[model samples]
Target chain A: MMDVKDRYIIDTIIEKCEGVRDPALIILQNVQEILGYVGKEYLEYVSEKSGYPLVELYGIITFYPQFKLNPPGKNTIKVCQGTACHVRGSDRILGTLEELLKISPGETTENRLFSLESVRCLGCCGLAPTIMINKKTYGRVKPSNLKNILAEYEEVDQYVVE
Target chain B: MMKPRVAFFDFASCEGCQLQVINLEESILDLIDAVDIVSFRETMKEHSDEYDIAFIEGSIVRPMDEERLKKIRSNAKFLIALGDCACTGGVNKLRNLLPVDEVVEKAYGDVYDNKYFEVEPAKAIDEVVDVDFYIRGCPIRKDQLLYYVNRFATTPPHKNLDMRFDVVPKEGEVDARSIIQYNPKKCILCRRCHVVCNEVLNVHTIGISQKGNRSIISTPFGVGLEGNKCIFCGQCLVSCPVGAFSEKSDVNKVSAMLKDPSNFVVFVVDPIAITSFIETLPGSDRDMGAEIGKIITALKEMNAKRVMDFTPYTYLSYAAQGEYIRDNRTMTFSSWCPSVQEYLEKFYPEYQRYTHPETSPANFLLKTIKSKYPEENLKIVLVSPCIAYKTSDAFDGVLTSRELSALFKSNEIDLDLYSCKKVDFDKDIEMERTYIRGVRSDYSYARLILEIAYMSKFHNLDVTLNVTPIEDYVYEFAFDSEEGFFSALLIEDMSKLRKYLSKGIEKYNLVEFYPCLHGCISGGGQVLTNSLETIDKRIAMLKEYKGVTDLKNDFISQVIKAYSQLKEVI
Candidate 1:
């Protein structure tokens, strides 16, 4: 069952989407923006309101890589796995990150603190085997440096809280 | 007329449609006489590129397939899509859900690199080239194919052909309406289930999710069906020409319960089951009553403690609803159809208040039996054409008319051989008036309810009753009075209902929706037959059974007795 707030958000999004050609997609995109992710509840609510079948709505969400079904973690780690990064041994860096965080690429940590993902390229080939955590970039990333990098973000969270 | 040279070809498919042609029995000879079999990989060793008509029987999934299909299209004067795969990219479209590379790797393993054909999403023949006609179904219907072949052979080549025989609409993708299990492997992706669910039933619960070969008929978000808005109507099961969508069989459970000495199993059958049994059973010339008798005897042989018709309970339900309406004077929705109740719960939750709280005939019977025989451990099993009843909590087991036939066949209890004796219900149950008949039509259930409402003295007031059979299966009934106005809508097919509901239901008092068109007579779990003539025959047979006319006296006495007994028990 959708709560009052979620229903309000969906209604507002649907209201804004009036006269839009692809309202189901538009509603889904707007709801994703408002809620950070398109939950099943929201999809069903939108489905009822829009009259678009839930299967079609879910299909639209999945067809686009931009839309996320799950909420992203506070800290997102993107390891460049482009040709340049591949040649510079970025596979080892990704493997190390996966081992350290206990979560593979496209998966978030148990604590919901960190998410790991592999991008084709970060446009930072000059620094091959590059890894980005949030806004900061760590070029020339190695398997050994993955633990220290993740710890740095955890330490920053502790510092911010203090 | 010169015999039109015909060839059969398949791409990515099971070639089941081609097999249907082979399974034509003696009719294959007539078909062969009509058309020259130039090339058929299924049965023929001969090969020929020359053919006036080409029957293509699968989806194009590779560049090689595309090239071959184009060649066939260019060569043949008329091209016919033979099956669901060739018609609507069938079950092979599930591959469209995943990346081509991933699919190839998973399917072929390391040998994928050595593959000659460039892999693509499975596509209907018309997607690539013009298809002159389509022989629909997972495996094309044998009779339909023969009809087309005869027409092609007899008709002039220059004459325009009618291609509208079994064509599904090319637009509006949606999911199935019921809880019928979809086996991706067996699904031909003909979209018949999708078409019937969306277009016919109007319950947009099933649709093509993903794209290409990876595409599958799935509920919204690929969630478990129980969580989805599916009404578990099982219309998709009957609509599915392939084994893709089928009812979860409770045959084994029922059989086990019957065999258990400790259990007092009660086998209750709906009135519609009589016609279905007569139709399903081979070489059984027995009428509806005789067939029901045979079925009762067969169940008795299988160790059933009690076998009874559920007609009395249906009357009880009607009486209860009639009484409630007289007292309340408020419009109440009929809860007799489980599928309608489910639809209301899922789609029209706001209208739930209007739904009559009375239990269905099957449930009422079970409750009555359980209350009457408190010491006996009763296991109620309902045998009917209704697949929706399987989801009901009232029955321990629900069997389709077809499944019941299968049980009889398996047990070697041939109905023809079984002595047809007049079977009686358990001595405790009263055999008053015979089961009501002629109320099995599209709007008949609602019509009967209205009749009952009228008999209950509600007709004394100016009551405007509007009974509209919207489609083959769906009906809308509206009742307006001086006090208030409420309408009861019965939509048999989900697709039509979905469309009506989408427009927002008008101020309705009570609504009755059925998943199967034409009520339980043509239920999803019934014996599968392509002929509408068979349904007509069954309806005629059901109508032949006498119905109670003096509802004021006969119905009132029965209702009064049942209610008094109920009050005593409480």
Candidate 2:
């Protein structure tokens, strides 16, 4: 149930992928980029557009970790586990986030404010023990800072609700 | 100690999966100890709706099936899909190949207005209700079923190692066209069917449609194999290690016909089929004479009116094939393999004139017997190494040597009791012709094509049919004489055939194609094997025992009459 503008963007992505090698995969990628994740409707749409059966499309979605079957939270929290970050205690930070958010890595919080994911590297090895919330990266982060970092997004959600 | 109350239910299935549980003979005691067997409709006279864990077989095909399944699911704490039908919509999905109207007519015979068969596209158990696990295979392997039952008392049940269809699987297999049933529930995803079909046969029919857990061996678009370029070559049936691929059985049909007093069921036993079946059996001497008598004795015990031997007719058949090939003025292939005939008809219809259905000895025998008896009740059943004979329904029933072995096992024929008693097939008529001058094997019959096609044309033509196989499966027959050059190609491999056909097949005036590797003796319906050693062994056994036994005299007279009538020039 997308509006006119989103429909045009998604439709154009599908049309571009038509007749390409591995069209289903390409369309799923392009749609996920625009819509944040390739959900059930997107999978069925891509299947219908590409003519690949549902099982194939569904299999691709489940197989690759990159392709999400559900919409992501408003703010994504990426805890870097790079070699330098691991040395500086990113695991402790990730553990605290998991406890506060009450969701494991790669899962959204119940309130949909933030989603947690542990990435290999954010390419900011100099900024060890870092956690990225949406576009902003909090460097030299401690485990205690996860509460304030997650709370920053929660306040914005509370304001919107008000 | 609370033993889990277990029940068994079946929907659109043979109920053989349920029976497989009981076949766990010694282990049945172990099963009863582990779980309380509450409901098994197939075995017990009574059934209880109340059960903790339900092992259900078969697929959902109608609203009633869906309703019945929901009721079972509600009653049971855990519902496990109990075979290919329940796990992957196995052979039940074969009906989904055709339109509901057409398949209904095929099965129920034109009672379209009936309420009982308000059919829906077949669905697996999970598609209707949540299935906790699956006991896979066509009939779940006895050891695996027992393991699942034992797990109830011992430890946690192993996650269904056989099935991985996390998503809805494609409608399993249509083998209606090619007699080779594919059940994904048993499939280990070996992709042997893909190689045999797409690469070897060049039919390009069966292949993997999806990937990973959702993968299924199917025709394109996951449609059934019914209206495809499948040449009914049961090559896949032999290639399949698991019983995932099997030929459609006609044993029950023949058994029923034999039991009917009004139906005169005449059994026609092929020599090679007997040879292969005997070789498969343990500690059997290579005495073709005694082995055939055993088969005849077994058939007679099964209430078969008359068991006729086809050994002598195999030689008679060679001459008929030779004449047919010689008579064809155009480039064509002469083969007794029905798969070859089907390939010619479906793919190369222009070569239809070259196809030899009239000369096919199996069909000829049935016709000969019918002409003599002129009785509507006579049912001619061919026990042969070929399942493709089922394609035409030419014989009232076509039983593979393996199926005949099953029939024998079921009837409990005393094979050891009837050894070397001088018992032969019915021979009442006398035939004067004996052109059966000990050929090497049936393959030598193809060599006769060049001799008969060339020599009879110009009697002065001194021709020796020299066969130089250009490739493993490609045979080039060339002989030069007073008449021009005589060139013929006998191709056994279907992959090589596509290249040859595309390169122009009109060059060879006497081309013969045997779709199977070594023709009917190594056919789809024989003792289950894909080994060339076994096939060559079977053929060697046939060659060693070629003219040891005699065919029926009445069958011989009819055969000779038909042969001469076909080629009046002879």
Candidate 3:
């Protein structure tokens, strides 16, 4: 599954991270950022290039929460489950997203348009409830406004499709 | 109503799990009555593409194995993984700790590029195809298989087996850190590994920690198996119902040595290892004495330079122990069981001096043969271990019987095709004249040694001895002489050994203690655990070829000289 381009990218990362003490974390962090998710094939390719064992890479991926084993949908939706957010109808917000996307938290839509997940906090708990679509965090997310927020990401999706 | 056409297929395994079906005996008739067995290669001749229920054994490795497994999956309505190999990739996955291409190239040499030989990291059958049911165990329990077959026949198809093993690894449970020795990925928290580690070896290196779903079999030694007093005997490996534990595979290493142009690989097979291998072999002719000869021929066909039968070689140790017994009344600890030596050295250091300090029979043969060969030639041994052989310069590489089976399979050296050849020797040592019996069991090996000592001390082989009855597998033997030169004790139980050590060992000239009743090799995971009947059968077969019950000085002199030369180096 590692194509020539992925090979080149992995090799470049290995070359850049070369000679660093315990470069596994540095290399893997870069890979997950670029590759969206660190899959088995990519981990093996990086392990081979970086001279780390596949098992070690698998350990690092599973140990840290940010490193995903499976590929995420093009857009990841993070709904805050912090105490402040939950007290202020974040359950309604998550339930609304589940209905609209037809997926529970921690599941990707069948079409791979969006992945749903629950986060502990978005730091702007003063906004009462928040959800993140990719990097853009929306403060004070309304259950009804979830459709319009999904439409915003769908625009970019449409642009790429054409 | 038509009978379900049941079938059996093997992938990367010894196919012993399928043979366990044959071990079912009278119940195998009941199994045949229920299903139309159309394609069991182990028990039948006819083959067919048709089958309703397919029992698949072994792991799906290699490109060809994958293709065949996919076909089997496509054809069958219900595909059940038959053993730990088929269910969880078994010992085949040990090779996955290394890269596949390198393993293939090293094992097969020039045939590396061929698609037929191209290997993938070993995977359980479920990894490749949708496995409907799973029956796990190195050789699955025959009664369990029968009960399942009956249940499936009478019930709805929704019963998909105990799918707990297939459950996803919870957050804290996924520890890939020590995946090489212990993978917590597929651990269903059965606590079999924990029990074996705690009770069996009494080495609490691994233990269950945490609570409920997240509980993991964590190592007590902080970092892993490294910090603990782990003997690396691989008892947990063999005892694990799931294929979680495996030693670093020396299969590819040995094959590479065999194929290397500069090195001459000597194959030394223990009778115990041979017995286990033959028992696992599907439809293997168990009754014949010539089967060992056929196995030798088969090893030779795999390009071994000189195939040495290890049974006859044990006479050197017997004679060495025998002569020593005559001179002294104290005991000599055997170095054959590596764990016993390791145990005494680590736990009971005071008794370490009593342990015999000689190269094992395999090393002795290697040393003597290497001396005869040009020193420039690199000679290595692909020897089987009765317990465990941690790699050392003494043995350049050690291979398991399962690995030996894999090599034999890949090379397509069918034992049925090879007519038994004259089993070889070094030509310098003729071992046909020496025969020591009762070596299969602990009691017998002791009796034989005491008999040898009496023959040496009294110069008579016909002296009848006295055996004082103790408990089961424990005994005290004394001759008519008050000097106690030939008086010996043979004890298999470990707890009694501790008790006897307090009582003093010097009362008897020899105290032969072997802890593992079936020998350590079976529990080492390299060799299959054979039924007592099968082990007895294997020993009986060797007895036909190797049974010369006497202590002849002519045979002893030749072997003793080579053995002493081995001692000179140490």
Candidate 4:
């Protein structure tokens, strides 16, 4: 975790969450960015300071699927299951990638190279069976291309991932 | 000369506004030089007799206040309703929907002798007594207060003493008439929105035409504001008076969201909206879109995670929607703008006959983010200019630009020197022009929808994300009038919109809506100062720095990569 200038910053942010003021959301987002996960330590710290119970904080953290308790993968895979891709054999492609990687949806590979998730129809539905790696998108991928796709990430790219 | 006797009184308020008034540092000197602040409990312990002007804050909630206000009105030569509570009753009136006693009890239930204070409906001073030229805004802007007081000082005694207190509808009183009566005679046509749009959004579409009484501020090229270059930013709506402009309401929805713990709340404010909060610096006229981005960044820096941008989605979807509306036989208003709905519902009530509740891209983005994130306790707020949307409650809080600016003052958040810094365009190494350039908002959503549609059709490509039940038209539908076909079928076209849609790429969980002619840069909350002053402030800010790096490009590249990689799995 990035060392905060003082505990007051985190304490102040956590303190404001009880009333559902939106500022808390920003603090959570920034903290998540710096720290891979919203850990129990932070939640407890927030609970102790903000007077909000840890359960409430935990409930909110779990409520948002985008939020996670574990470190994210080096590469997150968001399969486009939008209406268009569903009709274009996107399921088969997902199955192939998951099977090859030996991980279920939402689980990261043992190597921490990949994490799988799904999203609402990206506007580019014509590119059915689309997959987004980090921020770049690829359209019309055949199940056959799964091997080559995973191979690209075999070496670390210096480019920073947003 | 006898000190201009001044007495301050409160009715239905937290007494905070009164405190803020007394807190003015310089005003202490000027006020002491000009007048005597006698009956101020927050400031002075001593009481006073007769006064020239009685500065009254809060609303008339209690029956006793009515008697007290009448005495003040008779005793003083002038009575001025001080803050928004004194002017429009402020947030206190939101509780007017409930019984007056319930509101009182909710605040001080434990007090056994509460019977000493009998309260009625909280009303502006004008509701109870005559009020002279009043200053508006919750907590009130010191500048506006000074302006009014300064002007009062200079005007002749007859004019200065003349107080016109117009009685508006009481709080929570629902009127079926959606149209706000705009008497063109009342407007001076300062064209605050025009300067805001031109300088901020770079969409110089609204202009003044003709001459004298016939002359009016209008959309670019003299087009009907409804179906023209106007992007519906709501700047003009908030800026206009004599009931000239208003927005549809979603306040009920906001209340419901607040009640529900299952919804995570996010509030979206554009960067230009921040201009409402700060003193504009010199030489810093950044593009409305980029400026909004920077504000969102600052908000993020301030730990406002729920505060996000609607500009990106609005830009992406504008072309797609415009093309559909243009070619299709159906009559559709831009869903992004509540003011357009306000205009149609009021001026052309006949058109409201056909108005559809098609959600805008901002709405879409909000829903998507909520569903994707699924906060068991989430409520998304959209801080925007369309006050007509005050009743909508589509999100959680539809904080007006005025309310947003008030937040800065209320929280006493000072704008650091960093905030006043100008747009560093040259620093964006990757992009050609660093500062964002987009049309003003009236038709911003419309333009974006059209652009995306054309782009998608031309590229013959489509993106694949999970397809949720599209409650409204997504940004893929288009109508090709020349082709005699609605051309937005799923395709591989991505050429036309990829570049335009890719402007200011950032990951945001919330999408704000202003739909004003510009964002809140032209909001009612912004100081209506001289154009040269505003321009100078923007310019001065620009002189401070070289510019920012193309971190935006880097973020976009990552977002695209993520999307591309997702394709293989789906």
TM-score of each: 0.62, 0.54, 0.53, 0.32
* CAPRI quality level assigned to candidate 2 from its DockQ score: incorrect
The CA lDDT at B227 in model 2 is: 66
Docking class of 1: acceptable
| lDDT of predicted model 2 | 0.72
Q: Please give the CA lDDT of all the candidate structures.
A: 0.73, 0.72, 0.69, 0.53
**What are the per-residue Cα lDDT tens digits for candidate 3 across B1-570?**
677888999888998998899899999888988788899888889999998889999998877888888998899999999999988898999989888778887789885666577678999998999988888887788887887787666663574565433335666433434312666666677877666555655555577654566556666313566444555566666556666555666666777776776766666666556655665578855643466678777766667777665665566666667667767656676545666776677657899878775634545556565775644655555546443564344676666666567667766777768776546433434556433545434335556567666666665544556787677767777776554457777776554676788887767776766545445435364453324564466556556655555545445455555456545754
The sequence of per-residue lDDT tens digits that candidate 1 reaches over residues B263-326 is: 8888887767667767765564556666667778889989998887777777677666756655
Computed on C-alphas against the true complex, the DockQ of each candidate is 0.42, 0.04, 0.02, 0.01
Q: For residues B1-570, what per-residue lDDT tens digits would candidate 2 score against the true structure? A: 788899998898999888888888898998998998889887888788879889989999999989989999899887888999999899888878788878877878866777778988888888988888887888778877877777766765554344433334445544444566777777878888778776667676677655666576776444465666678777777677776777777878887888888988888887778867886577845587778777787778778888876644453455566555556556656656678888888777977876667666665576566765667798888888777788776678988888888887776665777767657788423343332322222244456545554544554334455668777777777775445556778776666776787877778766667656667766778766678777767766765665333323433344445456534422
The C-alpha stretches of model 3 lying farther than 4 A from their native spots are: A1-162, B1-166, B169-180, B186-189, B214-218, B287-291, B359-363, B412-428, B433-443, B520-526, B530-570
lDDT of 3 by residue, A1-162 (tens): 778988888888888987789989999999988987888789878856776644446656665778777789889999999999999999999999888888888788777888999999999988879999999999888988988888887745442221
Candidate of highest DockQ: 1
Please state the error at residue A54 of candidate 3 in Å: 31
> Candidate 2, B318: how far from true, in Å?
4.5
- Give candidate 1's error at residue B491 in angstroms: 5.3
lDDT score for residue A76 of model 1: 89
| lDDT score for residue B252 of model 3 | 68
Q: Which prediction has more favorable TM-score, 1 or 3? A: 1
